[model samples]
Target: MLPPPLNHTSSILVIGAGTWGCSTALHLARRGYKNVTVLDPYGVPSPIAAGNDVNKIMEHKELRDSNPDARSIAFATCTRAALNGWKNDPVFMPFFHETGVIVSGSTPDLIRHIEKDEIDSSKGDFITLKTAQDFRNTMPPGVLTGDFPGWKGWFSKEGAGWIHAQKAMLSAHREAKRLGVKFVVDDPTGNVVGLIYQNGDVTGAKTADGTVHRADQVILAAGAGSDRLLDFKKQLRPTAWTLSHIRMTPEEAKRYRDLPVLFNIAKGFFMEPDEDNHELKICDEHPGYCNFIPDPNHPGEKRSLPFAKHQIPLEAEARARDFLRDTMPHLADRPFSFARICWDADTPDRAFLIDRHPEHPSLLIAVGGSGNGAMQMPTIGGFISDALEGKLQKELKYVVRWRPETAVDRDWHSTQNRFGGPDKVMDFQDVKENEWTRINETEKSKKSI
Candidate 1:
């Protein structure tokens, strides 16, 4: 009812401060947008947010091994440019590491895509590993092979690699604050109850304390939490992932110190060695958690953003255990240091969903990471900003539009998300944190897939 807070000139409000939210805010500030404000329940880069991991892969190569690999290759190239451009900036340069990545299980389609992109390893961008030994050589003495016995893949982008999650967010966050962009954790003011709608336009948002901050434009980048607020529950679903970590011996640590991230797309899991923790982290990329989570604040708001369960579920543990035993046998018996469920937003087609609310002219939506949001750290904000300014490129324009279904195959996003694989964990809540160690001790001590 109060006059809209944002004026006609250009006042912006970005909801859900995760990867895209923070990046958009920082970029907007950099562009000299004076009234950029970000509101988040857990603050930008919430420790629990999907992008807040210790390390996430930043590969530009296509792992799906399909014709779409061509499109993915192009996407990767653009992402690489964005990352390289930002790494030179003193603020963000520190957070990114160019340790490189190794991707096995490349299909003929993947190779063709590489050819289409004119990619050649001799250019110092990638190395084609022809056999199991070649792949294992990149890893510790005896890791990988068996189910992937004849697997041949590429280990490329010597200067392309993973990201230090918190640092990336912190750097951008600091820059945004320095530029006079306001960032607030919803706790102090109030969590966003809903948007302010007047005259058939989204004017602003109202908080629990009965405060209304009007805005001329609102960007919803809440990730998994956007559905309830924006009324897109069917199109977007909050998904879960399990990340399990294991400590390594000094020798194991030394050997893996410079290891590239290992992603066996055909096999359904990805591995990341944490140099700082002297540990190895692995997770299930396919068949992600489809379970529902409760939203404490919005009761009856079924399927709110799922919480990270402390315990690593049995179904995930099996593949994880097999990966260690068959791929890295020596690490098979190591005790798990910790495990957690990482909740992220997934769209119907698994592609990104960044569009304006059909009914509200002032409301912009940027949700649905499909589990690949982290790598976009370099340019997601720019994409969202370009969309907001009506400057998106032809290819990227559709990615930001609202669509009930993607024309492509359902498996289109499976390459990046690797969702809907063989393994099925019918009950999402089958495991709890309290019995995590106990489950490890009793069940999966001597298992291999």
Candidate 2:
């Protein structure tokens, strides 16, 4: 079925070209929006790398423990749907891998959670491992299984996998270009104005370059830089999360060559084999000690290390190596090749703020994916498009009505009031510039409570 026609001639401006921005822009293009403009400080092949490894099978413990937001569940549902769409699409076939994912945790509660969620056992045609010995015998010899408390495994031959993020972004951009979506590489300096108000309502944004870009509505898919574009500072918090990919040597690869995307719940670390790059990609559940601090008014030059002081280069690398040694004893002494770090924007609730601004009803804020943005991109895009076009109001009904004040009730950790209030107008000066350092300091002093 064809997407509904855009109610008006809308020129949507996407602020960032990261996965979220690119995905949202592509969704708009797919919906037949012609005057869409995606603006990113960086050009194609964004510095951020994409991981298609589905660690949901393994990371269930972390999500339940650390993330209690219902939005995460909603995001997961959408992500699963998006994966299904990609798996069925001929063009996206080559980009997705269906290796299936495996989870091994030390807690029975974790196992029960997985089973209860119906994600524990694979519904697909794949062998299930009932014991540690069975898993070791089924795959490589040296793989570690002692850390897991019980032997519960799930293998879905049809479960969704990760995508090559850069490739997918490129594909979406290419398609957007074909659909006549304009590209802007510059950052917005002043407040964006110019919306076609029919009977007192905003229609779109007009760029500083005097471009009268009109639209029936606007969607904000800006990543970490989202707080700068709209007046919802208090409602949306963009925390910086860092992930380091520790490259394993050939000898280390030999030890875990056949290991399925393994989730080590005991240590809060996950590993996946990168067949194309011939390296084992590892990431931990430990949240990085950094916060995003970008100035929208006078945005500075981009930095290779966008993280805060807590994320020291040497210290982070050492942590990654130590984590690998502890989790996978087979590769303890192997020499690490290299490591790359990237930032993820998180919200206060740890769930995505995927709704419209309370006051600025015309503006939709798509920031704060926490770390699940890439996984849920396509669904998010579809939902945003549907919300704007008014086709799926019940689906996005919570988005418009939800408020940031009841964040803790929504499973978010309560903190100081950042955004002034619902009715307060947010400007460039109102942003908490040094908020990251303060948050880091606070975390260091407190125990893991």
Candidate 3:
């Protein structure tokens, strides 16, 4: 006599069809889960979601020289494999362009790492140059100038580059839908307004128009808006990056046409060339705009994002001009075609949280990109799926725990990209009187409640 066969028909509900949720859906389908569903206010590729960005860097390797023995480096080794998987797959490879990544002003150790990677992996090839003459002969004569006085850098031409994130995510969503994963967005049941729970267990969710959507488990990968749906407000702080694009004349674009993606470590900026090789996109990569929409019903609570009408503040605009002056002076005088904020759901250690809810084991949350989550799109899905199946590996699970500290936020934001003006940043907290203080006070109130 054998015990009753285990029931394997539990349904799963996912909120937000953004990167994490969509990726999770794909991996769940791959794992043979027949009833995985994703819910979002807007359909796949929310126009305002950070994953909808034009481009994002896919770091070929982890270059952390500060701690030589860190486990993160090994973790990156695994992630790099997943990146290569995407690059090899025909359907997905188109979105991941391995044009190359250039890191500047880095230490001697990083240069050595690049050198070693060149030899070990055929995907990465290294290039190093020194002196002004070397710059003229090897790269565009004025690309690395007096702005970066004491910086020596290297490039990995293989296995590193940028991804057309928006297209890739939409494709992944389509693939997941094709493979039996359910996606609910812009639906008549209305947008999810709350979580449904019973007997101290999270069983499902509720929609804005008072409809209930039940599931055995729920994964909330709503990006920065996670705080609005769940009580991880203290753990996940939503943030955005400052992105600028200079309208280059044809001659100017041709001059920099083949320039590789660049990282000016000391100056705190990076440049991502568009696919057409016409527009050059630059970002300070510093504490970007941490803007939010104040939740009307939940006074003092906020959702991190740009609604359709969000605008980039004036100081951030000025900072872009200053960054251009410091990095590419020729382009500094050119008119900027666009400047905007790219939101990210950040965690304390700059790591992400992907685990069961602290209070409800039946519910899971995946937020906290810390501005660098998009690149991991190819692999994060598997991790989320594994977590849901109680089979997530030990190494990453350790790093993605539910630890929250406010000091990290302060320290992370302290290194302001002043550019030139002393009062240069006009993030949400700065533009609105008492906005920053309001968040802190609100968090305190939540703790009390």
Pick the lDDT winner: 1
User: Which digits, one per residue and each the tens of the lDDT, describe model 3 over residues 317-395?
Assistant: 5665565665566666665555555667766666678888767888887888766678778778888777777677787
For each candidate in the order shown, give its overall lDDT on alpha carbons.
0.67, 0.50, 0.64
lDDT comparing candidate 2 with the true structure: 0.50
Once model 3 is optimally superposed onto the true structure by TM-score, how far is the C-alpha of residue 195 displaced, in angstroms? 1.2
Model 3: colliding residue pairs? none
Superposed by TM-score, candidate 3 places the C-alpha of residue 326 at a distance from the truth, in angstroms, of 3.7
Better of 1 and 3 by TM-score: 1
lDDT of 3: 0.64
Compare the candidates by TM-score and give the number of the best one: 1
Q: Determine the C-alpha RMSD for candidate 2 after optimal superposition of all C-alphas.
A: 9.7
Error of 1 at 356 (Å): 2.0
Which 10 consecutive residues of model 1 have the lowest summed lDDT? 408-417
For lDDT, candidate 2 versus 3, the one ahead is 3
Note the residue pairs that clash in candidate 1. Answer: 5-214, 144-327, 287-420
After superposing all C-alphas onto the true structure, candidate 1 shows an RMSD in angstroms of 6.1
**RMSD after CA superposition, every candidate:** 6.1, 9.7, 8.2
TM-score of each: 0.80, 0.68, 0.78
